[model samples]
Target: RESNNAMQMVEGLGEDDDLLRVAQELPEPSDLLESDDDAPIIRLINAVLTSAVKENASDIHIEPYENRLVIRFRVDGVLKEVLQSRRAVAPLVVSRIKVMSKLDIAEKRLPQDGRISLRVAGRAVDVRVSTMPSGHGERVVLRLLDKHAGRLDLSHLGMDARTQATMDALIHKPHGIILVTGPTGSGKTTTLYAALERINDNTRNIMTVEDPIEYYIDGIGQSQVNTKVEMTFARGLRAILRQDPDVVMVGEIRDLETAEIAVQASLTGHLVLSTLHTNTAVGAVTRLRDMGVEPFLLSSSLIGVLAQRLVRLLDPATKEAYRASDYECSVLGVDPADPPTLYRVPDGLSAGEGYRGRTGIYELVPIDDSIRTMIHDGAGEHELERYARTLSPSIRDDGLRKVLAGDTTLEEVLRVTRGD
Candidate 1:
């Protein structure tokens, strides 16, 4: 079977050589620039960005080395190099981005940041640019924001049936704090946006405070944080509270002041949704407690916690795609009748047969009466994990079941869950 597959792939490649050549020949930004005239560099950068929008890339990375410039794009959650330029052209590319973003082009030793808006294919797109000094040279990262890719439904987030049910129950609560915890690029914003979408209605006033609002919803009031002007998360929350919102979404709880305000908002008449940096749902409680939040306040105001991660999916259509090793299967407690397989890709993807996008694997902890009592008694993160494990079936176990059932891919599960 493997030999036949390889022969077929070779034949297919032979038939598509022209298409492959065109794709390979797509010019890099540096290739379009002239040695003396700088206009080409600007045009080239715009062209690259235009291509990115056309290709639906979420982020672009420009890394400069001693002898070359490497350009990479993050689609879904995977970073893949798209172009390489000669050493002579690296400086021009970097300066082009800095100038477009309105950063200090002359300063290379320090970090700088700015944003720009460009219209590609008749659609407006926002790009957030940040540059930091690296060992080889300056590293620039551009986060692409497409307003059209609005909030998604909760059911579309790849949660298993049991986990989805638990999450739904928690979000239906009228007043409490729900924390979605995960590292960066783990779909924290997407998950919270799904929850907010569910609760938004004509009867309720929903307000959100984000550093720079990523997505806009029609009925919700969104505020952007401007730290340069002293409009921060804490201050924003205070202002949002005065507006008598029934539900609030804080982009992230980064400090004690914001955490305290979020808790207080929940204790009052509002339901608060926010994100935290933690590895698991249970860890969220411990993190809050460690951040100086009173246990009693947490026990009362906390509704639920969701911890998630992003992982690569196995391309189901790619015969030679990597599979979960036996060790990974064991860690996820895979059943013999139905083994885990890499099947589906992540969100916002379009490429490769086996995997084109990434999916989110989440563990949810809803604060039931018993769990609330545990929190009230100062039960640590371990206690919450233990209790979560004692439930009928675990999130990890159930997630593996979904992989085996072909609802999602094991590659995605392991990517986010780190099963082994």
Candidate 2:
């Protein structure tokens, strides 16, 4: 089964030979500057995107240095440089990308951001383009959004059985807030969105206010926030509440007004799902209080908080059981004589199958009576953490189990946990 999965990861590379050849072998776009036609440019764009998708890359980066141009891809949260070309041609290549994203090709001095859709391997792939001015030239980064990348199932999110059960109970509550807390790129959005998808049975009015809508879910009324026109998170959320949504997802609680509105909505029989930028589940409560949300109001409307990080799954084909070190056992709170860790080869057998995808390692805090009392009394983050630990497993504990089960490595878990 492991080998079969690895095979699927590299299965379609043969079909991308044409596109990769054009992208890798073609001379600098500057060399073809004499022609005004855009066919070659379009082909170049296709090649870059096709290679990126085939490699299961999350983002593609084109960087220009003093003497050369470097093409890199970010896979499994690490950036690896894959291609190199002449420095003179990098600017023209970036301009072609700007064209696709509908950004101003003529304005290279200023930073710009835009999005574009491309057909790769007969599928639509969304690319978010961000270009910035640099010392040598402009740098281009494209975030690839694949529609079929993963299924939005709550049970399949890689939580421990207990955490999954706790989540199932909280999300079904008719009111109160469920917040997923993590730093940027820690997979908070995926977890919250999965919860929304799970409860979205077309029996309730669902609505969301996102800065920019990332995923499209059927039967949910999604709105994008445009600050220029005064459609900010706080204002938009207030509007959403008026629309009679049974469930509401605010992309993020970015400010005081938004946090207040979401908490108030939760008190009024609306299930509010939102994300917060914090390191721990307990930290979310302090974060809200720091934004001036009253403790009583917050405690009354809070259901639970999920603190999560995305860790790469090991290639089962290459994973091997190993004795845990003293430090490892201490971190996981397990015996060293036991096979407490599953170590895998850094270079997996294949791209997609072995370490092809990621799963959530989480620490969840379900706000019970005791937790609510602590919140109302204005407890500190550490006190909340200490209290929550008795009810739910820490993120580190959940991650170590995956290590013991050959699902991931201890080092991968530590890396995503910020070395906790």
Candidate 3:
């Protein structure tokens, strides 16, 4: 919903031109996949694929109802219908996707999930395919996992110097659990991979267990979770520990058993990196406790928490500085004597040029002996947050720094941070 509002504020830039360029760069469909070349159906499918890639669309949707089939691209979190066609061609296009994904096209009554690798614009794209039964026909949704997102290291993830240094120290620790917390699509996976990359060593055995392995990094053994085969996160991590690994990356701690195993791994002299679905760093303490992880274990083996959110960066070409408002100053905890500076995109700029990609705003909470004692005593989330403020900077302060540096807008920071 937040991203939809952001995209609605401005329109896409060079949309038609992006599609045209991708179409020209494509080699024949026969070369890319085992499909009949020179067929109109193949041409339409190829055109859609290249166009979606050029726009950096995260997902492509083909929805069929009573009469027409609508094709929409989820660009920057919002769904925009690019092309609409008759229901006649919908089956052919969806079938082509299923073939590439190695899914059973004939069994459309039951929902199916599969993956396809497509080389578009000279880059390999891992597309996650899902098909479900609808009123009139089937709905095909393709989630594109572009490797471009995982290419970033910590230095390039839009974090401040102090926060980055704190993270570096936390990740390099030989033993302890460092968890990244945020909602879905908050770049938690990218941050986890980046932290691992910084401390990754050939001498140390580092392994990761992801739901569906998204990024491919050499020298790292990645296992995909297959519930069908009884290979869940808990089972996978238990197996990985027997191999004598120095570092373990559990994609996410979804359940109590997995969380308990991750904490146990940290206590047993391994650096475990993972993510939690929490809004703030302090909230993680309460969340884990609610998940049945004992408070004593959390305080002992926990290293630090880095809560982050990705906010769209302002276009440097059109960035404009403005004075911070009274409410903004209060929220940032800035002194009125020394007013804080803020930045944003000037009005009248196109959405394409309004903001470029995104940068991260983080709240770094490094646990100290005092904070640990508070946790051990079963402190509430509010108390932990107040105590943590003395040990680290608040997320609001980090957002203000970005606004002062013209990296993002005040509104955007508030949106991602939930105005806390």
* Runs of candidate 3 exceeding 4 Å displacement: 1-38, 148-150, 320-341, 346-353
Residue-level lDDT for 65 in candidate 1: 89
TM-scores for all predictions: 0.81, 0.91, 0.86
Global Cα lDDT for candidate 2: 0.81
State the lDDT of candidate 3 residue by residue for 343-417, as single tens digits: 777888755457767778899898889989998999998999988888777776787788877788888888877
Clash list (residue pairs), candidate 2: none
| lDDT of all predictions | 0.75, 0.81, 0.80
Clashes of each: 10, 0, 0
TM-score (C-alpha) between model 1 and the true structure: 0.81
Sorted on TM-score, best first, the list reads 2, 3, 1
Residue-level lDDT tens digits of model 1 in 1-420? 212321222223322233223334535545555345654454456555666666678899988888887888887676778777665666777887776677889999999888776655556567789899998788899998876644377897878787788888877778999999888888899888888888776889999999778877879999999988999999999999999899899999999999999999999878999999887778888898999999999999998888776644455554342356677667666553554454445445555434546666767777789989999999877777889666534445655765665655655565566531
- Overall local distance difference test of candidate 1: 0.75
Q: Candidate 1: give the clashing pairs.
A: 311-415, 315-354, 315-355, 316-354, 345-357, 345-358, 346-357, 346-358, 346-359, 347-358
Q: In candidate 1, which residue ranges exceed 4 Å CA deviation?
A: 1-39, 135-137, 319-329, 332-353, 390-395, 407-412
Highest TM-score against the true fold, candidate: 2
